[model samples]
Each structure stands twice: as structure tokens, then as C-alpha cells.
Target chain A: MFATLACVAAMYLTPLVWMISTSLKPEAQATDGSLRLLPVPASSVVERARANYYGEEAAGGAWKPGVWTDPSVDFPRFMRNTLVVCALSVTGMVISSAVVAYGFSRVRWRGRGLVFGVMLATMMIPFAVLMGPLYVIFGRLGLIGTLAPLWLPAWFGGAFNIFLLRQFYMQVPRELDEAARMDGCGHWGTFWRVIVPMSRPALAVVALYHFMFVWNDFLAPMVFLTHRDDFTLALGLQMYQSKAGNTPWNLLMAASTLVVAPVLLLFVLAQRQLVSGLSAGSVKE
Target chain B: MTREGRENLAGWVWVSPWVIGFGVFMLLPMAMSLYYSFTEYPMLEGPVWVGAENYARMLGDGTFWKTLWNTAWYGAVVIPLATALSLVIAGMLTSKVRAGGLFQAAVFIPTLVPLVASAMIWMWLFNGRHGLVNRALGLVGVDGPVWLERAGWAACALVIIALWGVGQQVMIYCAALREVPESLYEAADLDGMGPVRRFVSVTLPMISPVILFNVITLTIGTLQVFALPLALFQNSKGGPGQVGYFYTMYMFDKAFADGEMGYASALAWVQLVLVLGLTWLMFKVSGRVVHTRG
Candidate 1:
């Protein structure tokens, strides 16, 4: 049983290991078809790593490599663009979704049940159905080719986040809110003083999930952002791969590693919350 | 105002962002898309009404049918394989294994990789000449075909990539498995049932509802697969024989690349109907099989 489990784990992880291994090698070693997992001649490891990332010309003051040195496919710029979008969208999504969730969970009013039901149903409407008209709408608003199209809609509450937050808020005792009200707190005041402070972990889950979503999103950026300057990392990686004809495998892998490392780091840090949150959200509701 | 009226106003005020967002982003677009499907609109010009032409044209478009078939075939193969594989992995994790958390983390980490990065990683892994996959196969004296350059093999390569992301479902299954009653297992053991028989009778039925839920989600997800194939092929043109083309990719190409907004709107409507229909059908069919607790 131990041997079987080890093999299953290896089967799942080898591709990622190979990706990192490929990224560190020079172009010749990467495509040599040899079975070595490391760059040949360990003495040249640092030089090869420098060349793969910072470009050989910059690292050695010599001839240029291909796509890695191209200024337009700037990795740092793409990272900045992706970070900007993630920050704006994640903050907006968390705040708005929490407010909407508060209404659904804490406040009892006419038509609340029906409105909540409508919010849940909206989750089933696939993005494919929305991309067309959304593009036209953004075009008319003169927001196409800009980052506005990517982060603007997130200012509104999303269905899944609202549902998750609502589920969390429902567990907070109504007595707390009533006590705050007894102290002359309004609904807004009670929400901030009582509910928000208690739901930190759930809020973190929503923020992390939305952050990952914006980071990983490709189709929206691909459709809306026409200029290369506004491309997110996901789009920039594709642009690098396709635009760099006969792209060196090592540098491509390096770019991929750069794109994947942050998400992996985030996952490692919050593994418990992310795993539990994902399973709980799906299975319970 | 009455107390009830005051509560109602406050509730609406709190939820106004979503309410306005729902109308503008979802309802307005859906209504516009439905209207656009019946017209010939190419963004730069005003829409010209053309009754049923785009939908009628779709029936005769070979690429439309081809992509539809490709997407359907992908969903059919991927949904079942991913479901079973995840269930087996979840089963293994639940059986008192040492270092189980380490194993679970290893399985779950791949799903966190961005899709574009995942595509690049798989493209390198599936490379015909120097790919790790082919090197491993060569060790067994088996020759592997050029995956992305071939027709049938491209689809198989895609299925393999889809299987790699089944860890999310596995985690869900693990949670559901822990919720199963130990008394039922003891009862099965008292009846002299073996491990396999006990699992089939006890474990399977208890977790059937979660399975149904996961399968439906997978169906919706797999049928709309776009990024992996698009990145794998490195273009919307698709791989050899258009085998890598999918329904949404085609819709995207028509709308954005070819400027056929009306036709793409029609395709989008068809996709929405098909997804809704498949979801409804799954729920209807699984009514007897999914054992939900009261």
C-alpha cells in the first residue's frame, strides 16, 4: 500500500518537477532528449540559469538569446499588470459580496428569499453566453483594450462568493446583532462591529479565491485587451509561446515556472483553508 | 413607514450592488444576445434583422458540427474517467495511510497552477521528440506518437491533461467518505461481506449524491473547455484535422476573430440550451441513484 501511494504521488507530481528541471537548463540541454533531470555539466548551472532568465546578453555581455530578451514580452510588466487587476478585483469582490451576503443572511425582509434564489441561479449562466454582449457593451463604453474590462465587473458581487460568505454569516448568532442594536447600532454598524470581525477566515477564503481567479483568467483578457501592454501573465505567456516562433524550450519553461510559482506558494501557505473551503463549499450546498 | 416596510427598504439598500449588477451584466446581456442572434451585426455596423438565418446556417456549417462533436466526445470521455480516478484516489487516502496529508497535498497542488502555465507544461511533456512522457514509454520499448500533431491522439492527450486536475473532486470525496456511518460498515462486516462487496454496497450508495454533484459540475466545465486546447495548439485554428477545436473556441473565433457577432450569438444560445438541458437531464436521471439524507 505504501509503495502504491508513493507511485500515485509521483505520477501526479513528475510533470511539475520536470517543468522546473527544464526551466533551469540551457537551450541545447533542454532539447537534447537525454533523460537527465539536471542541466549537464553542473559547473555551468549558474550561468545557464542566468541566461535562461535575465538573458545571456545581459548576464554575459554577449550575443542575445531569442524570446527571453524581447522587451515587448516583458515578464515584469505582465506581473505588474496582473497584480493590479488582482488587487482591484479581489478587494471589490470581497467587500461587495460580503455586503450582499449580509443582507441574505442577517436581514429578514420581503422578497429576500426570492432575490437570494435568483443570485444562486445566476451561477449557472456560463461565461461563454456573456462574453459576446459584454464585449459589445464594453466596446460601446470605450473600455475595450484597457484593463477596465478585466477588473470593473468585479466591483459587483459575484454569485459564488456571495453564497459562500452568506453561508458563513448565517452561523453568526442573531443575538450578537440584536445586542449591538440594543446599543444603538444600525444594520451597518452591527455588520461592521459584530459580523465582519467574526468572519475573517471566510473573508480570506473569498479574497484568495478571487485573487487566484483574476490571476488565472485568460479568456477575458484575450477577448477584451487588444494591446500587448495590457496583457496579464496568462495572456503574456501565450503571446510568448506563439509569437516566439521556434521558441527555446528552456526559456519557455522558465516563463511558465515564473507564472506558476506564486500560486503554488499561496497554496502551500493556506493549504488547509483552501482545501477545506473548496470541499465544504461544494459538498454542503 | 411600517416596521416591515423599513426592513424591506434596508434589505434592498444593502443588496443594491448585486441587484443593479444582475440587471445590467446578466439580464441585459442575455436579452441583447437573444435579440442579436436574429440579426446580422458585425460590431462596426448597425444590426440588420435576419430571421433565423444564423441558426439555420449553423446546421450547415461543418466546423460548427465538428467542434460540437469534438466537445461532446471530450466531455463523454473526461467526465467518467476523472470521476472514477478521483474516487479511487480518495478511497486510498481514507484507508489509514501514513503520510496521507503529504500525499493529498501533492495531488492537490497541480490544480493550483494557472491554466496557461499548465498548458505550457503539458505541451512540453507531450512533445513528440524529447517529452518526459515519451521517454518513459520508450523505457518499456513502446513508441509514442506525436500527440499534438495527430488527430485521435490529440484528444487522448487532452483527456490526460483533464485527468491531472481531478484532485479537487478527490478532496470533496474524502470529506463525503468521512461522513459515512461506521455502523453500516460494521453491519456489512457482520453479514460476512468482503471489502469489495462492503464498498460497493455501503460506501458507494452513501457517497452517491456527492458523485452526482461532481459529475454535473464536470460536465459543465469540460464541455466549455477552451484555454487548454487553444494554448496546446498555440492558435484558435486548432490542431491537425481540427481535432483540438471545441464549441466555445469556435464561438470565440466567430465573434472576435471573424467579426460574425450574430452567428456567434446564435452559437452561444445553443451552447446555453445544451448545458441547461444536460444539467436537467442529469438531475432527472440521477433521482433514483443519488441517495440524499433527510
Candidate 2:
């Protein structure tokens, strides 16, 4: 059992390890078919890293003047665009979903159950069905070629996030709400002072999930954003891959590592929350 | 006004965002999509009504049929393999292994890599002459096929790529496995059931509902797989002989690249029906097999 598990682990880890290893080598070494995991002589690692990241210009090559003139991808700009989308979408999703969830779980009102049922049904409708008309809608609204199409819809509650938060909110003791009400608190005050404070873990889960979603999303950016300057990291990586005919495998791997690094770091830090969130989303009571 | 009326008003105010969002983003778009599916609406021009013309054209369109077959084939192969592989791995991890968390992390980490990045990594690994996969196979004195260059091999390459991200399903399976009661195992032991029999008779039934749930989610996900193959082939059209060209990719191309909005809307509707039908079929077939606890 131990040996089998070890083999499975090695199988899974090899691609990631190879991604990093290939990024450290020079172009020739990367495609040489040699099994060596590092650059030959290993002293040129820093030089190779600089060339791969900042382009040949960093290694005593001719400097280009304009952004379009430079052959190297503007990775930092793409990272900035991706971060902007993530920040806007994650914040909006968390706050809006929490507000909507409070209505579903905390308040007793007519037709609430029916409305919640409709929201759950909406989750089953795949995005493919919406992407067509959404393109036209965004074009008409002049949101194409801008980042608004990517993050604006998030201000409205996502069905899944709202459901997850509602599930969490339902577990909050009703007595706390009563206590707050006795102190002359309305629904807004109770939600702010009592529910939101207590449900931080669940809110964090929603925020993290949405952050990763926006970060990894490729198709939406591909369909909505037209300008190369507006591209997210995922879209930029694709553009980088296809732009060069004989793209240096080493540099490509380096770019891939940059795109994957932060998500891996986040995974290491929040594995528990992510794992529980995954189970919570699928495994029902 | 009565207190109930005031509470109702408050509820409407609180949930208004989602209500408005659903109306504009979902219901309105769906109605428009259905309307546009029946017309000849190019992006640059207004819709001209063409009753069922787009759907009829799909019947004779060779690429449409090819892409549909490719997508269905890919989903049929990927879904079961991913589910079973993850379930087995999850089973192994749950059986009191030391360093289980470490092993689980190794499995789960790949799912964190974005689709485009993973596609790039796999492209290098599956390169015909110099890739690590071919190099490893060469160690055993076997010649490796050019993965992304041929028809059958390209489809096989995509299947392999799909299997790499089974880590998420594995994590979910691990959680489900841990939830199975210990007393069932004891009962199986008392009945002198062997390990394999114990797993089949006891563990499988206990976690069958989770298996069903995972399969449904996997079906929905795998059917809409777009980014990985798009990034892998690096073309709006798919790889060699269009084997990697999928339903969503075709829809995307028709809508955006070709500006065949009406045709693409028709394709989208067909995909929606296929997904709904397959999901319903799974539920129907699994009605007897999936064990729900009382």
C-alpha cells in the first residue's frame, strides 16, 4: 500500500516538478531530451532566469522602445489586470452573497423558499447557454474590450455562493439575533454585528473560491475582453504560447510557473478551508 | 401595515440584488438566446427570421456532427475513468496510511494549476521526440507516438490530460469515504468477508450516493471542457483532423470568429438539451443503485 501510494504521488508531482525544472534551464538544454533536471554547469542559472523572465534584452540584447515593439510579454501588466479582476469580483461576491444569504436564512418572509428554489435551479443552467446572448448584451452596453464584463456580474449574488453562505448562516444561533433585536438593532445591524462577524470562516471560503475562479478563468476573458492590454494571466499565457512560432520551451515553462505560483501558495496556506469548502459544495446532508 | 407586511418588504429589499441579477443576466439572456436561435442574426446585421433553418443546417453540417461525436466520446471516456481513479485513490488514502495528508496534497495540487498553464506543461511533456513522456517510454525500449500530431493519438492525449486534474474529485471522495460509518466494516468482518468483498458489499453501498453526486458533477464539467483543449491545440479549430475540436469550442468559433450568431445559438441549445438529457438518464439508471440512507 505504501509503495503504491508513493508511486501515485510521484506520478502526480512529476509534471509540476518538471515545469519548475525546465524553467531553470536554457532553451537548448530544455529541449535536449536529457534527463538532467538542472542546467548544465548550473552556474548560468541566474542568467537563464533573467533572460527567461525579462527577455533577451536583460542579457545584453538590443532594447526595444514601445510595448508592441518588444517581443517579450508584459507579464506584470497581465498580473495587474488579473489582480484587479480578482479583487473586484471576490469582494462583490462575498458581500452580495452574504446579504442575499441573510435574507434567505435569517428572515422569515413570504415566498422565500420559492425564491431560494429558483436560485438553486439557476445553478444547473450551464454558462454555455448564457455566453452567446451575454456577448451581444455586453457589446450593446459597450462593456466589450473592458474589464467590466469580467467583474460586474459578480456584484449580483452568484447562486452557489449564496447557497453556501445561506447554509452557513442557518447554523448561526437565532438567540443572538433576538439579543441584538432587544438592543434596538434592525436586520442590518444584526447582520453586521452578529452574523457577519460570526460567519467569517464561511465568508472567507466564498471569497477564496471566487478569487481562484477569476484567476483561473480563461474562456470568459477570451470571449469578452478584446484588447491584448486587457488580458488576464490565463489569457495572456495562451497568447504567449501561440504568438511565437518556435517558442523557447524554457521561457514558456517559466511563464507558466509565474501564472501557477500564487495559486499553489494559496493552496498551501488554506488547504483546510478549500478542502472543506469542496466537500460542503458537493457532499450533501 | 402589519409586522408580517413589513418583514416581507424587508425580505424583498435584501434579496433584490439577486432578483435583478437573475432577471437581467439569466432569464433575459435565455429568452433572447432562444429568440436568436431561430433567426439569421449576424453580429453586424439585424436578425432576419429563418424558421428552423439553423437547426436544419446542423443536420447536414459535417463539422457539427464531428465535434459532437468528439465531445461525447471525450466525455464518455473521461468521466468514468476520473471517477473510478479518484475513488480508488481516495479509498487507499482513507485506509489508515501514514503521511496520508502529504499524499493527498500531492494529488490535490495539480488541480490548482490553471488550465492554460497545465496545458502548456503537458504540451512540453507530451512533445513527440524530446518530451519527458516519450523519453521515459524510451527507457523501456518503446517508441512513442506523436501525441498532438495524429488523429487517434491526439484524442488519447486529451484523455490523459483530463485525467491529470482528477485531484479535485479525489479530495471530495476522500471526504466522503471518511464519513462512512465504522460499524458497517465491523459487521462485514463478523461475516468473514474478505477485504475486496468487504469493499464491494459494504463500502461501495455506503458511499454510493456520493459516487452518484460526483458522477453528475463530473458529467457537467467534462462536457463543457474548453480551456484545456483550446490551449493544448492553440487553435480555434482543434488539433490534427479536428479530433480535439469540442462542442463548446465549435460554439465559440461560430459565435465569435465566424460571426454565425444564429448557428451558434442553435448549437448552444443542442448542448443544453444533451446535458439535461444525459443528467436525467443518469438519475434514471442510478435510481436503484444509489443507496440513500433512511
Candidate 3:
């Protein structure tokens, strides 16, 4: 049983470890020659690449034993773009979801169920179908080639987050609301003092989940942000992979490693909360 | 016209953003898209009422039918496998395993890898000559095909990437599994039933609603698939031989790339009807779904 568990752990973590290992190895060692667990001695790196790549050439005369040029890739810029996008989108999502959730959770009104149903139904609609229409709309608004399309939707109330928070808010006892109201606390005051303060687990889950989704979302940004300079980390990694003049695998790996670690760390930190939320607060119980 | 009315107005005020956005972004667009499906506009020019030519074109496009077949084939293969994988894994993690939380977390990690970065990772794994897959195959004394370069193998790669995101669904299953009643398990044990029989008699019936939910949702998701192929194919609109052109790709290319908005809108309406039909079928079949409220 222990061995099986160990295998499971290894299977899950191996790619990540491989990513980090490939990142640290000198460019020549990981990509060109026999991909090794340990980096080849730095001195033998160029020789190995030459013998492996050039010696296998159709004509030896046509081969050039290109010297190893450890390319310094622009990892920092890609990492920055990722951070900015996640920050903007996640912050927007948290605020928007919380406000919308408050309306659903605490406040009472007519047509509430109808409004909630619309949100739920939209959730069922696969986002892929909306892309072309959104593109045309954004283009007409002159919002093409910008980050606004990626994050602006969050400010209008994302259904997934609204549902998540609304579900969690229902779990909070109504007596708190009654108590706050008895103290002459208005709706805003009651929400700030009672509901928001108490729903930390749900809020944390919301923010973390939002961060993960937006941080890893490449397709939306890829479609919307067209400029080379505007690429986010997800798209930036691909750019590095296909860079002109002999793409550097090591540096691309390096950038990917840098980009993925923070999110991975965040996931590990919040795993319990996230998984608990999945079972407990997710799916609108 | 007292407390209820005041609270009602406040509630509307709070939710007005969502209501307005939903109307503009989803409801209005959906209705407009329905209208435009009958026109012959390409966004560059004003739409002219053409009634059903684009729909007829879609039927005859050859590519459209092929894409639908591919999307359906993919949906057919993935939904069952993914749903089953999630259920069995969730059962394992929840019932038999002690490291339930850790295992759950590990499994969900792949869903976090951005689609593009994961695509890069997969390309390396599937690299024609020196890929890790081919290298692994060499160790087993069997030669590997070029997974991405070949049309069939590219489809296989698409399926694998889609399956990798099954992590999220697994977590959802894990959530659902916790809600199952222990009394049923106790009843199974007391009846001297074996594990398999116990699962059939008890576990399967209990979680069937969640299973149905996952299937219906995932099928919808798989049918509308686009991003994976777009990432994998990169610059080539579809994939090798347009094999990666799921119906969504055809629609996207028609609207944006080919500047044929009216045609694409037609395709979208067709899809909307198809989806609604399928959803209705699922709902009709959902009578058998066992909802465990506990």
C-alpha cells in the first residue's frame, strides 16, 4: 500500500521535477544529447551536442559544430505578465463575486431565482461558443489587442464565483444577520461586519480558485491580446519555444519552471481548502 | 410597501450588474445570433437575408460533417472514460486510501498547468524523433509513430490532453462521494456481499445524479472544444489534414479568419439547437438518476 502510494506521488510529481531538472541543466545537456538526469560536466556539454547532432548529419562536411551559446531568455518579462494578469483578474473576480453573492445570499427580492437561474444556465454554456461573438464585439469597441477583455468580464459578476460564494454564504447562520439587524446594522454594514468577516474559508477558496483559473487560462488571452509584447506567461512560454534563430529549450524550460512554481506553491498551500470547497461549498449545495 | 419592498429594491440594486451583463452579453447576443443565422453578412458588409444558404453550406461543407464526426468521436471516447476514471479514483481516494487529501491534491495539479505550457510539455513528450514517448518505446523494443505529425496520432494527443484535465472532475466526484450514505455500505457488509457487488447495489445508484451531471456537462464541454487544437496546431488553423477541426474551429475560422460572421452565426445557432436537443434528451433520461440528499 505504501509503495503504491509512493508510485502515485512519483507519477504526479515527476513531470514537475523533470521540468525543474531540465531548467537547471546547461542548454546543451538536456536537449541535444542523451537527456540525462544529472547534467553533463559543463566542459563536455558542447562536445556532446556536436557529436550527437553533427555526427548524425547526412554529410559531415555540411555539419557545423555550433558552439554552445547559453542563451539568456526573457523569463522575467513573461513572469511579470502572468503576475499582472492573474492579479487583475483574480482581484476583479473576488470583488465582483462577493458583491453579487451578497445580493443572492442575504438580500431578498423578486425575480431572484430567475436571475440566479440565468447565471446557472450561462455556466452550462461552454465558453468556446462565445468567443467569436466576444471578439467581434470587442473589435467594434476598439478593445481589441488589450488585456481588458480578459479581466473586465470578472467585474460584471462571474457566475462560477457568485455561485460558490452564494452557496457558502447560505451556510452562515441567519442569526448573525438578525443580531446585526437588531443592532441597527444596515445591509452593507451587516455584510461587512458579519458575512464577509465570517466567510473566510469560502472567500479564500474563491480567490485561490479564481487565481488558478485566470493564471492558467491561455486561450482567451491568446485570442484577445494579439501583440507580441502583450503575451502572458502561458502564451509567452510557447513564444519562447518557437523563437526565431534556434529556440533555446533550457531557457524555455527555465521560464516555464519560474512561471509554474508560484501557482503550484499556492495550490499546495491551499489544497485542503480547495478540495474541501469542492466537496462542501462547490456545486451549490 | 415596507421592509420587504425596501430589501427587494436593494437586492435588485446589488444584482443589477449581473442581470444587465447577462442580458447584454448572453441573452441579447443569443437572440441576435439566432436572427443573424438567417442572413448573409460576413461582418465586413451588412448582413443580407439569405434564409438558409449558410445552413445548407454547413451541411455540404464536408469539413463541417468531418469536424462534427471528430468532435462526437472525441466526446464519445472521452466522456465515458473520464467519468469512469474520476469515479473509480474518487472511490479509491475516499474509501480505501488513507492519503485521500494528498492524492486528491496531486491529481488536481494537472488542471492548473496552463493550456499553452501544458501544450509545450506535451509537444516535447510527443516530439517525432527524440521525444520521451519514443525513447520510452525504444526501451520496450517497439518503435513509436510521430504522434503529432500524423493525423490519427494528433487526434490521440488531443484526447490525452483533454483527459489530463479530468483532474477537476475527479475532485468533483470526490465531493459527491462523501455525500454517500454509510448505512448502505453497512447493509452491503451485513449481506455478505463482495466489494464489486456492493458497489453495484449501493455506491453506483447513490452517485448516479452526480455522474449524470458530469457526463452531461462534460459532453457539452467536449463538443464545443477549440483551445486545445488551436494551441496544438499553432498557425495551422485546424491540425494535420484539418483533422483537428472540431466544429467550433470551423465556426471560428468562418467568423473571424474568413470574415464570414453570418455563416458562423448560422453554425452557432445550429449548435445551440443541437445542444438544447441533447440536453433535453439527458433531462428526459434523468428520471432514473438517484439523488442522495444526505
- Candidate order (TM-score): 1, 2, 3
Candidate 3 interface RMSD (Å)? 2.5
Docking class of 1: medium
lDDT of 3 by residue, A1-285 (tens): 545655665666556666666655655566663657656676664544344222223365654221122223345555677678788878887877888899998998998998888788777665555666777777778988877788877777789789888988898999999999999999888889998999888888888888888887766776688776667777776666656534555545556665677788887687777777666644445
Task: Provide the TM-score for each candidate, comma-separated.
Answer: 0.97, 0.97, 0.89
Native contacts recovered by model 2: 0.73
List the TM values for chain B, per candidate.
0.98, 0.97, 0.93
Model 2, A155-246: lDDT tens digits are: 99899999998888888899999999999999999999999999999999999899989999988999898898998999988988899776
Ranking by lDDT: 1, 2, 3
Which regions in candidate 3 have their CA more than 4 angstroms from the true location? A1-5, A31-35, A42-75, A243-248, A281-284, B96-98, B292-294
lDDT of 2 by residue, B61-100 (tens): 9999999898889988998899889988999999899899
**Per-residue C-alpha lDDT of model 3 across residues B192-282, encoded as one tens digit per residue:** 9999999887888877877777787887777788766776676475668777878887787787688787888888877877787788798
Two-chain DockQ for model 1: 0.80
Model 3 misses residue B92 by how many Å? 2.1
Q: Note the clash tally of each candidate.
A: 0, 0, 0
Please identify which of the two predictions, 1 or 2, would achieve the higher TM-score against the true structure.
1
Candidate 3 vs. true structure, TM-score: 0.89
